[model samples]
Target: MVKEIERAGLPVVHICTVVPISLTVGANRIVPAIAIPYPLGNPELPREEEKALRRRLVEKALRALETPVDGQHVFED
Candidate 1:
């Protein structure tokens, strides 16, 4: 799906918590998030904390849209 989306000439940014797994599966571009169970939000965490984490990761993913690269890339903080 990632490749197909990119092949269609659209900018693709894959947000994943388990970054290595996504990369192993051939993700063209990936942004590291929190964790696998909760890529954007962790249920055990307080709502505010989860929201903050999600917001931060989301911002990074969005910035990735403006980043141009020639191949698979990983964004980390």
Candidate 2:
């Protein structure tokens, strides 16, 4: 579905915590975070940790858009 959407000329952004999954799925525009389950935060961690994780993830996402790729690509942290 993602590739289909992109192929239609509408850009797609995949915000992923798990880099491997996004790579296997062939995501051209990708953002990577800390983990697979939460993508941004871990409830077991301190509040500061969670906040910092979220901020970093979002920043990576913004950067993913600026990157240009010839084909499917995966952005990493």
Candidate 3:
């Protein structure tokens, strides 16, 4: 779907736990996530901490969307 969106002339940032899968799917902008079950949050952590983590991930994704890429790129912390 990421490729399809990009093909439509829209940029997409794919947030997933597996970087390889995102690459295989031709995601130009990729953001590494925490886990499969909880990609943006850690339930074991305190509520505030989890929220912070999710916020950071979202921030990174937004940054990825802003940045230009000639090809596949991974936005890592």
Candidate 4:
């Protein structure tokens, strides 16, 4: 999926909890998520805070798209 898109010349950033899996699968742009169940939002967080966290993660993904890399790169919050 992600690799196929990148192979076609489109940039792809994968947001996933398992960094090792993403790296092993050859994901060029990676963003570490909170967890597998709720990668974007944490139920424990206040609603507004969760929203902010999601936004920050998205911003990191966008930044990852603009970054050039020779291999897998993980962007952390």
Highest lDDT among the candidates is held by which one?
3
**How high a TM-score does candidate 1 get?**
0.84
Candidate 4 TM-score versus the reference: 0.94
Which candidate model has the greater TM-score, 1 or 4? 4
Tens digit per residue, CA lDDT, model 1, 1-77: 77678889888899977777778877777998767777788898899988988899888888888888878899877
Query: Which pairs clash inside model 4?
Result: none
lDDT of each: 0.83, 0.77, 0.96, 0.92
Query: How does candidate 3 score on lDDT?
Result: 0.96
State the lDDT of candidate 3 residue by residue for 1-77, as single tens digits. 99999999998999999999999989999999999999999999999999999999999999999998999999998
How close is every model to the real structure, measured as TM-score? 0.84, 0.73, 0.97, 0.94
lDDT of 2 by residue, 50-77 (tens): 8987888787777877777788777765
CA RMSD of each candidate after superposition: 1.5, 2.0, 0.6, 0.9
**Candidate with the larger lDDT of 1 and 2:** 1
* Superposition error at 11 for model 4 (Å): 0.4
lDDT per residue as tens, model 4, 1-77: 88999999999999999989999888999999988999999999999999999999999999999899888889875
Off by over 4 Å in 1: none
Query: What is residue 59's positional error in candidate 2, in angstroms?
Result: 1.1
